[model samples]
Target: MNRTPEPMSRRPELPFHWTLVLLLALSVVLAACGASGAPSNAPAAEADQERPIKIALMAPLTGGAAAVGEPQLNFVRLAVEQFNAEHGTNIELVEGDTELDPAKATTLAQRLLADEAIYAVIGPAGSQEVAAVAPLLAAADLALVSPSATKPDLTEQGLPNVFRVVPRDDVQSATVAQFLLQRLAATRVWLIDDQSSYGVGLVDAIEAQLRAAGVAVVRESVGQDETDFSALVTRMRADQPDAVFLGTQVASQGALLARQMQEQRVQALLLGGDGLMTEDFIANAGGATEGAYVSFFAPDVTNLPSAQPVIEAYTSRHGAVGPFGPPAYTAAMVVLEAILRASAEGPLTRAAVRDAIAQTNQAESLLGIPIAFDTKGDIQNASFFLYQVQGGAFVPAR
Candidate 1:
C-alpha cells in the first residue's frame, strides 16, 4: 500500500454509444412490428387507433354503361389519390361493379353495408340503380353521393344519406325546352324515349315544358333494344317537326335512329340528354350528330380555378377526363372535407361524417362554389347546362 498502492484497477465503463445503438435498433424493430398489423394494432385491440377511412365506389365497370361509369370511377380514383397525396391520410377505395343493373346494384349495396369500415359510397351509375339501393343505404345508415344519378325522385324521397352532384333530369329537360323555344325557335317537336325510367321521366318533363312554352308535340315514339329505326324515322319525317328530342341512352339503337333520320332526309334538329352526349353517338351518327343539342350537368372544373390542378392531374394519369369531372372531383373533396371536419372533434364514425356532411354549408370546393346540402341531402342549387355537338365536339350552346 505504501508502495504506490498498486495503481487502482480501472473498472470498464459501458460503451454508451453501443448501448444507444442497440436501443435505437430495438425501437425501430418494435415500431416495424407494430406497423405490421400486429395484435396490438388489430381492429379490436386499440379502440382509438386511427383507421383509414374507406370509400365504396359502385359502377358498371363491364357493361353497356361501362363507357360512362368507368370514366367516372377513374376520376374518383384520381381524386382520391390526389387527396391522399396532399393530405397524409390514407383513404381506401373499394370498387364494386353493378353492371348498370338494379339487382346488381342492390347486391353491391348489401355487401358494402356489411363492411363496417366503409365510410361512404360514391355511385350506382343509373338512376334506377340508385333508386334500388337507396333503401339499403338508408337502413345501414350509410352516406351515398352520386355523380351521375340525376333522378328527381332520389332527392324527393327525402333520404337523409343520399346526395348527387348533377342536376336532376327534370331540370335538364326544362332547360332543353327553354333553349328549343327561346334560342332555337323550334315550334313543333317529336319526342322519343327508350322506355327507361331516365328516358321516360325526361321525356315527360320535356313534353310538359314544351307544352307550357306553347310548342306543339307533333309525334311521339318509344324505342326498344332493336337497332332498326326506319319506322321512327318515317314517323318523324311525316310529322315534319322542327326538332326531335331523344330521351334515350346513347345506344346502338339511338345512334341508328339518328342515322336513319338523316338518311330519310328528316331535317329536324336532334336534341338529347347527357345520356346521349357521347363520342359514340357522334361516331355512329357521323355527320348527323353535328348541330345536335344535348343537356347535361356542367363540368364545373373547366371554369373553376381550384379544379385546374385536379383536371391536370387526372388527365395526366387517366388520359381521359371523366364526365361531370368537376362534380366527381368535388364529390370526393366533399367526402374528404367532411371526414376532416368530423375528425377534428372526435373519432371518424359513419354517423358523425354523415352529420358533418349534412351540416356543411358554404364549404369551398374545386367547383369554385360554396357547397351546401338541403334538408334532403341534395345540393340546393344544382343546375344543368346545354351543349351542342359541333364538329364532333360538345361545345356550350350559344
Candidate 2:
C-alpha cells in the first residue's frame, strides 16, 4: 500500500484569471448594496410626483356684470390653456362664481383658501367684491390679482397681497376729466351716479377734478333701477351742462339714461366710465350710444404687439373680441409667472408663491410693458385712455 501512494492524484487548482473574476464579482455586488443603502434625491422625486399647481378664479359668472366678467373668465381660461399646452405642465383652474355680490365673494374666497391646493387667486371683477374678499386672502397669506377692479382704495388699503391689472379710478377719472375739459373744451359738467360703489367713486373723483380744473359742475343726479329718467334729464337740461358723466354700470340704468337723454333731445355730451365699455351698452341703448365717451383701463389690444397673438388666440377660441381681454390675460400671466418662480426650486407652496408675487418687479407682460408694484401694491405708472362710442363701438379718443 505504500507503493508510491499510487502517485497521489494531482488536484487541479483554480486559474489566476478565475480568482480575479470572482473578486470583481464581489466588488460589483458590494457597490450595488452601498448605492442602495444611501439617501436618494427623494425630495425632488416626491415633488415631481406631487399634485399639479392650482389657481382659483373668482368672478361674476352669473350676474348683471356677467357680460363683462364672462369675457374676463374666458380670457383667463384661454391663457391657462395656452400656457399648459406649451409648458408640458398642468395648471388646475378652479372657478367660483361670486355673482358680483360681496358676501358671495367672501364665501367663495374662503372656500378657495381652505383648499390648500390653490397657490393664487385671479379675481372678483368688481371693486366692491375685491373689497370684500381682500381681507380673507390677506389673512390666509394668499395672493389676489384682480383684472378689473379699479377703485383706488383697493391698493390704498395697505393690503400687501392685493393687486390689480387695471389702473385705479383716480387714473381713469383724471384722464377722462382732462379729455372732457381740455380736449373737448367743456366748460360745464353734469354728473350722475347709480349709487353703486364704482359709480359713486368714479363720479366723485371726476367731479372733483372737473371743479379743480375750473369746469362748472352744473348738476349732479343719482338714480337706480329706474326705467324713466325724464325728471333727471329735465334737471340736467335746465342746468345746460356741456357734458354729462354716466358713472354707472352698463347693465344698471345706464342704457336707459342714454336712451332717455337722446329721446328727450338732451344734447349734453355723454360720458361714462369703464362700466360702459361693453357691447351690451350699445346693444341696449342703440343709436343713443353714438358720440358717447368712456374711460377705461382697457389697452388697445390690436396695437400692442405682444398682446396681438393672445388676442388672436382668444378671438379664435370664442369667435369674438373679449372685454377686459388684455387685463385678464395679463392677470393669468402674472399668476403663471409667480407659480413658475415659486416652483422653480421645488413644489409650489402658497406662502412662497405669495411672496414671489409680492416681490415681482418690472416683469414684461402681454401689454408690451413691465409690470411692477409700488409700496401700495399698485402699478406706479398706471395710465388710462379715453374712448368714444362711434357706430356703437369703442374707438380711441385720447
Candidate 3:
C-alpha cells in the first residue's frame, strides 16, 4: 500500500470561457436588482395613471332653457364634488351647452369625442338633442346617461350606450292620461304640443290613450318659442275642454300659456310635463299657475330623505333644486360609480365603462327610487309624479 499511492481522484474545473459566462450572467442579475431598489424616474407612465378623469355635461346651458340646464350642471357638479371628497377620485366636468338644438348637440358630441380624456356624458337633456348625438356616442362606445331625455325610441333603438334616469314618454303619457280620466275626471281634454320631439312624443301617446278610453280629445301644436298663446287660449275657452295638457319643454311657454289662459278666462285645468316642473314655471307664470298640475319624473328632492344632504349643500350654493336637478344628480352618480368600477377591473376604456353602466343596480338613488337599467337602457319600473301648484308651491297630488 505504501508503494506508489494511486493518483488522487479530483473534480474537473469549468473551462475558463464557461466560468466567464456564468460570472457575467450573475453580475447582470445583481445589477438589475440593485437598479430596481431605486425610485423609478418614469414620470410619463406614472402621470398617465394618476391623471384626473374627465366627464362632460351636455345641457342647454344657454338660451330659453338655461334655467333648467343650469341646475342640471350644478347638481352633477355637486355629485362629482362629493364623490371626489369621499372616494379620493379626481373628476373634471366639462360643460357642453346643447341649447335645445340637436345640431348644437351633435357639435358638442363631436368635441367631446375628440377629447380622449372624456369617458362619459351626463346628458343631452332634451330628447331631440339625445337623438342627435346618440348615434355618434354609440359608435364611439361612449356611455350617455341622461337625466331627462324621455323619448321611448331613444333607448328602443338597440344602442348599447344610451341610458336615462327618467321614465319614457310612453310610460309618462299613460300616467298623464290616467290622471286626466281618474284624477281630474275630465270627459273632454285638449292636448297641445310644443312641436319639439319631447312634446310630440308625449302628446301622441296621450292622445292615443285618450281616444281609446272614450275621452274626447283635441290635438294642437305650437312652436317652442311662441310667446303669443292667445289664439290657443281663446280656442280652449270656446271648446271648453275639462283640462288643457301643455306638452311644452319651454318653461316660459308654459308660463305664457297659463297667463294667457287666465286673461282669456279659460277655466280649464292646466297640466304640463316635467320640463315645466321647475320653479321657473311658477315664478314666470305670475300667479297664473295656481291650481295647475305638472307631472315630474321624481318627487321634489327636498321631499326625499336620501336627498336631504345633497339638497342642503346644493341649495346653499346654487339656490334651489328644480325637478331636473335631482335626476341629473342620480345620472352623475350612476356614471361615476360605473367608471370607478370599470377602473377597478383594469385600465379604463369607454367600452368598459359603458358595460358597467348597463349593468348598474343601485339599491337606492338620490331620487329615493331603486335604480336599475333594463336591456333597453331605460330605468326599470319607471314612474312619474304629479304635483299641483297650490299656495305658490308644488304639492304632490293624491
Candidate 4:
C-alpha cells in the first residue's frame, strides 16, 4: 500500500531548482525594499512637501511708496499668522522689496524664481511693477496674487498664474464715470493724468466711458514729477468742468494738483482714484482737498465686521493701516488657501498652487467682498466705493 509514496515530486531536481528560484526572487524584493534611497520623484516631492513652506512678499519696503508697501507686507504677515494658528501648518515669508519700481520688480522676481524654493508672491504693489514681472511669473508658472495693481491691460494679457484682488483700472474708471454722471450730474468732465501707465490708462478708460454716456470729456496729460500745476489749473478754471478726474498718486503729484486748483480758483470738484485716499494727500493739499471726491477699489476695511480684528491687530502693531492693506490681506488669504489645497492633493509645486488659486470663490472675503477669479484672473463681482472729503477727512459718500 505504501508502495513508495510516489516520489514527493515526479522530478526531485525540478522541485529544488524551483525552491531556489523562489528564494532568490524573495531576497531580491527584500533587498530592494530595505534600501535607504528615496522612491521615484522623491527629491522633488520632499522639497515641495517640506514643513514650513516658504512664500515671498514683493513690495516697496523702501522708497517713496514704502509707506504703502510696508503696510501691505504686514497685513500679509498677519494673514499668514492667522492661517498657521488655525490650520496647524507652518509657513514662512521671504521679503523681496520691489520698491514700487518696475525694473526692481523684474529683478526681484527673477531672483525669487532662480532660487527654486519660493512658492508664491504677494505683490510688487504698483501696476507698472506687476506688468513688468508678469511675463517672468507666467513663464515660471508661479502664482502671483497682487493686492493693488489696477492696470486694465494686466488681466487682459491672459496670464493664468497672475491674480489681483482689486478691480482693474478699466472697471474702476467706468464705475467712476458712471458715478460722476448719475451722482454728481457731471456734464463736463476734465481728465488729467501723470502720463504714467496707471494714470494714462485710467484717464483713457474713463474718457471712453464718459463719452459713451453722453458726457463731455476734456483730456490732459502731465509728467509724474510735475509739481507746479498752475497752467493746468488755469485751464481748468477757464474750461469749468463740473468735475476733474486726476489719475495720479496721492503723495507723488495728486495733492499738489489739488492745492494748485484751489489757488487758481478752479471750482470743479476734484475726483480721484484710490491713490488719493491718504492723509498725506490731505496734509499736502491743506484745505484744498475739501469737497473733493475719491473712489477706492475696496470699501474701507475699518468698518467691516470680518476685518475688525485685522484692523485692530494691524493698528496695534503698525499705528495705522493703508488703503492697500485689506486687499493684501485678502490676497494672502487666497494664496494660503491655494497652497494648502495643493498640499493636500500632492506636491505643492508652483503650477499646482496656481491651479488651486484659480478656483478661489471666497464667500466672505476679509474686505467684505466675495473674492473670486474669472478666467482672466480678474476679481469677480467687484465694486467701487466713493468717498467725499468733508471737513478735511475722507468720509463714505455711499
Top model number, TM-score: 4
Error of 2 at 114 (Å): 3.5
TM-score of each: 0.77, 0.76, 0.74, 0.79
Model 4 clashing residue pairs (backbone): none
Estimate, for each residue in 363-388, the C-alpha lDDT of model 1 and write its tens digit: 57666667788887777676677777
Please, what are the lDDT tens digits per residue for candidate 3 over residues 1-398?
A: 66975555655777643653454465466457546854765754475577568888999998998977999989999999999999998887877788889998998798778665679999989988999899999999999999988777898888999999999878889889999998788999999999988899889989999999999999999988789989878878999999999998887788888999999999999999987877788999899999999888776768778778888999899886777799999999999999999999998999999999999999998888889999999999878889999999899887
Clashing pairs in 2: none
Candidate 1 local lDDT, residue 230: 85
What is the C-alpha lDDT profile of model 2 across 236-354, one tens digit per residue? 77888888888887554667788898887889888888877777777888778788887778666666676778778877777666556668878888888888888896666777887
Q: Count the backbone clashes (under 3 Å) in each candidate.
A: 0, 0, 0, 0
The whole-model lDDT of each prediction reads: 0.76, 0.78, 0.87, 0.82
In model 1, the worst 10-residue window by lDDT is: 16-25
Question: Candidate 2: where are CA atoms >4 Å away?
Answer: 1-49, 63-65, 195-197, 225-240, 250-267, 280-286, 300-303, 345-348, 362-364, 367-369
Runs of candidate 1 with Cα error greater than 4 angstroms are 1-46, 195-197, 225-240, 250-267, 298-306, 324-326, 362-370
Number of the top lDDT candidate: 3
Candidate 1: C-alpha lDDT = 0.76
